[model samples]
Target: MPRQFPKLNFSEVDENVRLLAEKVFAKVLREEDSKDALSLFTVPEDCPIGQKEAKERELQKELAEQQSVETAKRKKSFKMIRSQSLSLQIPTQEWKAPSVNPVLSPATPVLPSAFLPVQVPYDVPEFQRVSISGDYCAGVTVDDYEQAAKSLVKALLIREKYSRLAYHRFPRTTSQYLCSMRDEKWKVEDEVYPDFHSPPEENEDPYNLDDAPDNLDYVIKIKGGIPFVYDNKEMMELNEPRSLPYPDLETYTLDLSHVLALIADGPTKTYCHRRLNFLESKFSLHEMLNEMSEFKELKSNPHRDFYNVRKVDTHIHAAACMNQKHLLRFIKHTYQTEPHRIVAEKKGKKMTLKQVFESLHMDPYDLTVDSLDVHAGRQTFHRFDKFNSKYNPVGASELRDLYLKTENYIGGEYFARMVKEVACELEESKYQYTEPRLSIYGRSPDEWQNLAKWFIKHKVYSPNMRWIIQVPRIYDIFRSKNILPSFGKMLENIFVPLFEATINPKEHKELHLFLKYVTGFDSVDDESKHSGHMFSDKSLNPDLWTSEKNPPYSYYLYYMYVNIMLLNNLRRERGMCTFLFRPHCGEAGSITHLVSAFLTADNISHGLLLKKSPVLQYLYYLAQIPIAMSPLSNNSLFLEYSKNPLREFLHKGLHVSLSTDDPMQFHYTKEALMEEYAIAAQVWKLSTCDLCEIARNSVLQSGLSDKEKQKFLGVNYCKEGPEGNDIRKTNVAQIRMAFRYETLCNELSFLADAMKTEQISALSK
Candidate 1:
């Protein structure tokens, strides 16, 4: 036989039975152990222990599974919430379920992938195309139809009952009958009942007495297959667009409360359309419509030919009253055509009106004397205000913000210099002082103090030496802040010695000693050109010095001349120099000499006009002429000198192409000197190449080196100088130089022929 199935032991037969026994036993034990235990549900004390234990274990397993499922679901929900929150905060993250092993329950519902609120599309034709009548209903359902029918019924009932009419008395019983019949069936039930439908056969027939209501002569058709009665034909016709329910006033006053209620409860656009329609019906809205149209046009891109538009009352009002372009154009047109109509000077008038009107081709007479008088009363001015009164007020905080924002846009050095210059200007204006002579031309003490303070406050680090020099003069009082010791020392050391050298040697003997000490020169000795003394012997041979006799002039003159030469040389040597040594200073000197010459030539012996030395007088004229071709023989001493003495005097601060030999040693009358110089140049009409070489040599001989001298020579001094002086000097110089070089020998040959015989008699004498 096959192995028999395991015999069922009745003592351990059912597992569920065993668990239930154990649960009963446990409950009984628990109730015995504690007073607050669930006594009502306790099992007997004799329940099987094995059975109770099995039941407790089974129940605990079920509870743990439930809690696990709940916790997992909660965690999933938290992850979804976190993902949603993170999406809002950082929009890049995609939302997803958090769990790797999500066990979906049968009861749990799935969510949609995305959510968005619903909205009605407004661009549909029906939405934009507003109609005046209820006959045209957009997107209305059956409910809308029922409501319109009810309103019509109500309006008819009110109309018929209020007025004494036989049809009205028949209406209540008839209406009830009709309602009952309608409730029963849509079609008429009574055999005697009239059909509730349109008069299909009659298209334009006159209304019948029965079809109309009491006292109403005409009826208007509505959208819901209903009709309204009006006392007057005009009222019915006027209500044709809107299908107004109660158009007959004498029969019964129309209750517009329903219309208002509909509007209050309707869509905003719907209400707006109806309101607009009402206004149009009540008033002449043409002007308002035009204004609206103009507003739209003005807000769009501007039209160049804005004046090409229709003009009427609305246009005139817009032109006169509005600030918009269309209005301005209209006003301008009106002013041009009917100037007298423009009451420009009225209290209500503004300058914009005046401006617009004046800009047009209007007749002035039309603008009326009254308008002119009005404008005169207001003190109208031609100049427009640079700043607008509305936007550019002084107290506006936006102005300060703008200034702060734009502060960086201004270059740092420029701002500092501007402030310093403004301070100087203020001081100068207050004192009314001229330049150079600080005592005579400088500011008063108080002004100086203020200026110094101002400069100190505004000063910043500067790379320029000229600005560096100005700082001390403007900010002396605030030395700690404004003056840098190193820069101040440089100025003091260089300028003091240089200045002392030029001091009156007779008055300041110590200055003379200081110059010698500073420059390491020997003591100076007295010498005179008349006594056959050369400047070389009298003073240690200085740089740029020649063995030629010293011209009869003051030592100060010689000193200044030397200093100028020194400055010029230093500028040539230094790569970068300030704009200080310019034609202004050089030309100023020339002007000084020329003015003196002019005064002396005119025999005006004013102390200021009379120049002490004939040498300076000659030099002044020489400054006006070419220095290299000077009759006084241009040899080793004058070689490379190209600067014209006449040009120098006429202009100023001209770079010497070895031209600044000695300002003091120059002596000769400008005219006589020019005459002699012209004789030589005319006699030696050299070739263009040779004359160019002479010019180049003169420029090269200037205090500037080859490169710098070339620059100064390249720039036409006569042209670069002041106005009224020769700016075309380059062309003239080129022409003169070329003529001299091209025909020097030829001109010399002709000179003998040109010479008069009278000169031979003088030679014989």
Candidate 2:
């Protein structure tokens, strides 16, 4: 029999737990001052009396445990098991890649498995392994250990549920352990991954619309914020919607509250804090001992190194995809060649490129990277408003609209040309890819159709680029201007058209074609802005949210997750590509934002706030959720480069990759992605193996199709551990891979053991 988990109902939860969640929400809202908010999320510099007392008490408890004979015996046993169970070795046989057809509708094509057995050319040299021979629960009490493990496992289950519902990727290694803890068998067929359409072949036309599936004519309605699909208008009138799995708001809130309460739990925090420290120390020991051996292994591998490894710029904005210098050059060249070409209209008067510059009292010839004023500086630090203004060239919004926006008098021709130039450079590099975000403000239903028309008209499709749709969280601004009636309208305008296009592709051919290259969605805005509203079951639904006040970050994430979940289920049935909710989270916000993202996002960008919450950080590590970090971007907006946590997170075994958030503002080179890597490698003193490993993480986190990933990373890239790594292709050392794999397994084994102990205790009772 399959294991069944208990259902969560908000009303049935303990009152104390409910109050704790409320307290967390209230605390986040109350922290309006930047300094106070920062302190609330980060470790306080001035240790309070309560914290000091707690530390003293913990030290006394540790001293007492050191003197206990039973504790000593338990420690010995743990050491013996640790050494015997975790002895690392190279595999003699290659594992075959599993056929992962995540969505199996009749219209879906089954692609063949890309895996093929290949012998490793060089053996991974024997290296020192860090084995903890002492009590695994040395830092915390056994009771505390059990509590942390239970809470963590519960959190993973919550994430896995959401991931599978949306066809998101969850690590197979973690899934197997989860299955074992539940006393069930884990099968490859149970794994679900997001389906991304492969790029058109060289002989095929990217703009061909004849291949769209026949129209199903399904009816879609957004009653509140969630979409319901009906077979036809008759089914809709009868209120008989399709049998797609829709998320329940109450259940989601209950699960969210559970995670919220766990973050504040004393025992769990203590356990997680200790484990994170241990992970960092373990990596240090491994590096000191196996550093040379890992390098030696890399030295023997031929035709691959850090420079040649495929790296994806997983987080970048389309508006600022090019560097400031590139933008300046493009502007000058346009003025030099097409000065008489009509490019814009003001007050219904057509204006040429030269005339627009003349109206601004400037000449394109005089514009240098410095005079452009697009680059961010010290003044922009902690000032999102200032950073946003940097999007405009020379403090002029006219230039931005004419050059950066997708809709303009010239139909974004100038912007498309710049983007294509960037893409051409990437093609020349042959080892880089990017997922640039284009804005979809959800102001009207025509936004989708217009954007699709712009895409097709400009012929902006690039093999080295995958597009992401970013929804700016500016509902309050729109509501204030009376541009939107309610939040529900906004949600409808954003998603309803996509649902229609999916259900009737022939009628929406342009959108249907354009969506093939879009791989994910991103929620982006200034996270530091405070919204006093607390999201709960009692809060107003989207349709009734008529006030000018904006909802909180959690509110936005939950709704986005819901729509994406339902949309993915609908598309899966039609054999269509799905979207991943890769939100811009934890950049600079309340810790609660990270909590919401943990359950909703497939991965997140700029997770600097994780450093403050050890519990969430450990959970992120356990789940192996990929994070795209941009230190230069942070330096100009939130944190300093020297204080960035990317290096620390990397050392602690987090799935982190380097990204250039906005090359125009934060970078100074034509090869923006390479500039990002070079700076990170130099500042962090990263090794070749470290750089390659990060590059490998980027490919896995990106929206590239499975066929492309296999060609780049290796056929068995889907597998975990050293077996998954192909050094000849990835340039990552197997020794490093083995250490990472063993460490994760060791941590997971502890959780599995704790669950077993709980089961045994229940049986005894």
Candidate 3:
């Protein structure tokens, strides 16, 4: 009924209303006929339109929430942009080429007043070539001549000790008196089928008849230096070895000619003795008998060669050891010819057997254990046999004393400065012109290039003094990080142009010195070894240099050697080097820093000695220390193990320094490290004086100028007057309080006493 009513009104409606009504009518008609189209306007028949709209809203909300969650997640996950500063500018100029200044000649420093009026020992041209013994020829005594003669006699006696009586049985050459009697008597028989005719016996003199033989015998004697003659035969048995005496050899004036005949070509012990006897007889050379005293057991072999007091090029030390008197005699003789020559020239020519024997009797260089132990080598002379693996022991308390007495004068601050100076020397380096010129073991080429570029940029940004970076490698394998940039192709843009502009020819020496200083291979390992620079091209697995090429010019090595000797002596005197660790950082590392460092005294000293080019001295000194302390030959791993805490170095008498080997990398200025040491020692229960000694040793081991050394020894730092004792006393008291150790207190007392004595000595001087 409602649809019929709407259809009747559809055409009668106004235009706007009629269109609406017609649309309504058409919609009604379409809805009535089309069941599929009716559903467009209707929600699900089972649900209300409001409910459907609510569900649609819920769906829209869900979609919006999902998009919001995704948007939020994206925002949360995005990373922030980052920017870093890159320094780039003029390449490092330290490696730059030089330009000529206004002055064309090289600059020279004027001699200071102290160095002026220089006097060298002698000029090469004005020197004479006089013989060493020429001036002292009259110094010999009659006793010397007698001793020389006696030496020859002694040799003859020794030969006679082995002689035996020999009787040749022939048909009795001459039957003196033969009698034939019928009752009782003797009969004489003749040979050759003929009756033997005997000469009548002659009556003997009453004095000689008692001992005279029935047969004819003869005796002959000659004056001094003469030969002997025997019965009817010219048997002048010379005192020569096994062979018949020189034919017709007869002595005359104890001349060199007669002695030369016996000793000129023979290896007989008598050769040198005979020659010495002749010389003594002629020159009276016994007055020059100054020789080193040696114990019988410790005495060196007597066969050592000694030149006459006239030879040149004689080593002073050898002379001191073998025959100091002879050396002095020679020196006295040559004083006029080359008065200024510090040492005698060694003669390459050899001595005769007689000469060898003469020295053997005197053995001037032989050092007895007693003599050397007390007065020459350290009081404690320890000889280690490398062939034997026995390790000599040192007491802990003794080592502690040494640690307490080390040199602390350089202090932390000045020590840092010295390190800084050493590093500064490398600042002026440039890239090497050669390929692979840098170390393969140090910073790699990439690292260096980065550094170079960074350095240039840094300089441009905030130019100041150049960075004085120290490049000392800890081990041989750590040298791969020292490369410079190539032309702009790699290693950032900074290295190439910078290297091209700054590099020069003469700078190679500086580079080498710097590299050597950093790499710790400036010298050879030993004189016996060779440089074999060829090793530079191959893998660095072999020994690189010998001790000869890298001689120690500094006294640091000597000081270190002395320290080791001192430690050994102390151990023999007292007991050990130390018993506890100094202050430490944390609980992680071992508490053996002080002990390990103390043990390193030998190695450190060895390194220092290598600087001096005294391989013989080094070896000699090494022989004086225990083998356990030495890092010789191929025993590095052993040395390292001995240094380790796990190894428990039972033998502990060692003297060492806790040095700031490479302070820059440790982020410690020398002074700062020292301060830390002081703090740590307190925390770790270490002795104060022990720390002081470590500081002192650092200074003592330093290569400081003499004036600097004086300052470091506390000679100049203390008050000028005895009245200043108050301050020193107060300081000592404070240290005692802080350390609270009796040993430290005792060391301080000793130091005070030493200082007083030193001051007194200085005043007297």
Q: Is candidate 1 or candidate 3 better by lDDT?
A: 1
* Candidate 1 structure, TM-score to reference: 0.17
lDDT of 3 by residue, 268-325 (tens): 2222322222322322221122111111101222321111000111000100111222
Better lDDT candidate (1, 2): 2
Q: Write the per-residue lDDT of candidate 1 for residues 316-435, one digit (tens) a residue.
A: 000011112222233235445544433323256533323533444343335432322211111211111211111111223222122211122221222344333433542333311111
Candidate 2: stretches off by over 4 Å: 1-7, 32-50, 59-123, 758-765
**How does model 2 score by TM-score?**
0.92
Model 2, 428: alpha-carbon shift in Å?
0.7
Clashing residue pairs, backbone N/CA/C < 3 A, model 2: none
Lowest summed lDDT across 10 adjacent residues in model 2 is found at 103-112
TM-score of each model, paired residue for residue: 0.17, 0.92, 0.19
Top TM-score model: 2
| Tens digit per residue, CA lDDT, model 2, 1-765 | 111223456564555677899897777566554365334334643322238789889778778877877656555554454444444222223324324311111110101111122344323445676655555576676557767889999999988887887788888778877887787777777788899999999999999989999999888999879899999999999999987775677778888888899888888888888788889899999999988888977887888888898999999999999999999999999999999999988999999888999999999888889999999999997889999999999999999999999999999999999999999999999999999999999899999999999999989999999999999999999999999999999999999999999999999999999999999999999998867777887888999999999999989999999899888888888999999999999998688999999999999999998987888999999999999999999988888888899999999999999999999999988888889889988998999999999999999999999999999988988887776788889999888887787778778777776675643444334
lDDT at 711 for candidate 2?
A: 92
Task: List the lowest-lDDT window of 10 residues for candidate 1.
Answer: 310-319
- In model 3, the runs with Cα more than 4 Å from the true position are 1-653, 660-671, 705-707, 714-765
Give per-candidate clash totals: 43, 0, 64
